[model samples]
Target: MGMKYSDGFSKQLPTLATVGAALVSLYLMSQAMKSIPVGTAYSIWTGIGALGVATLGIFLFGDRASAPRLACIGLIVAGVIGL
Candidate 1:
């Protein structure tokens, strides 16, 4: 979203994509909250999103991969599972 807004002319496509992603995220969160505690649902959602984004960054964007980063992702997964 920040990236989309950083464009001086307000890039419509990036803005729309960001908005769409946010809406879908909210809808999924609402649905998940129906069966899970709000904290648990939110944490799980955040963990998954973070891990996914990090993985994509490493694979597609050439973000440097490090052992600590992988360990942290594992920890996030464990925490989510523990919830």
Candidate 2:
């Protein structure tokens, strides 16, 4: 019974995470769009999301931290800053 509960909880984790992310993203985007160009806001939002996911993958999921990957991440941040 304990194993079944744990398995069910694990299965729901992704769904919960997705919903939480979406809600926060929507709220942030709406707030940002009020003061910035939609294109700029969206670009920055996506850039931040990509960088965050990459960092999490590297630290939590043991993703490869290759030079090219790090360089690309830097480029993304630079692009966001350029905006």
Candidate 3:
């Protein structure tokens, strides 16, 4: 959504913020690897990311939240918890 802004500053700010957020997330994930297994940590990280983005898309962009879509999200949550 921020990427769709017409002004240059608005567009660039969101892009920069996204880069900073990603860096922080990666750093935290790397730190978690000290205790958690590599495969499990990676799986949980990706699963949480996917679930967060999907859920936000529904609220922020008015993306569809149909039953099947929700069920898939539930599956991702379950997988993350199982890990």
TM-score of each: 0.82, 0.81, 0.87
How do the residues 1-83 of candidate 3 rate in per-residue lDDT, one tens digit apiece?
33434255456778787767778999999999999999999999999988998998899889999999999999999999899
What are the Cα lDDT values of the candidates?
A: 0.82, 0.83, 0.86
Q: Tell me which residue pairs clash in candidate 1.
A: none
In model 2, the number of clashes is 0
Give the per-residue lDDT of model 2 (tens digit) for 1-83.
Answer: 22233465576766566667678889989999999999999999999988988888898768999999999999999999999
Per-residue lDDT, model 1, residue 21, is: 81
lDDT order, best first, reads 3, 2, 1
Clashes of each: 0, 0, 0
* Stretches > 4 Å off in candidate 3: 1-10
Which pairs of residues collide in candidate 3? none
Q: In model 1, which regions exceed 4 Å deviation?
A: 1-9
List ranges where model 2 is wrong by over 4 Å: 1-10
Winner on TM-score between 1 and 2 is: 1
Whichever of 1 and 3 has more lDDT, that candidate is 3
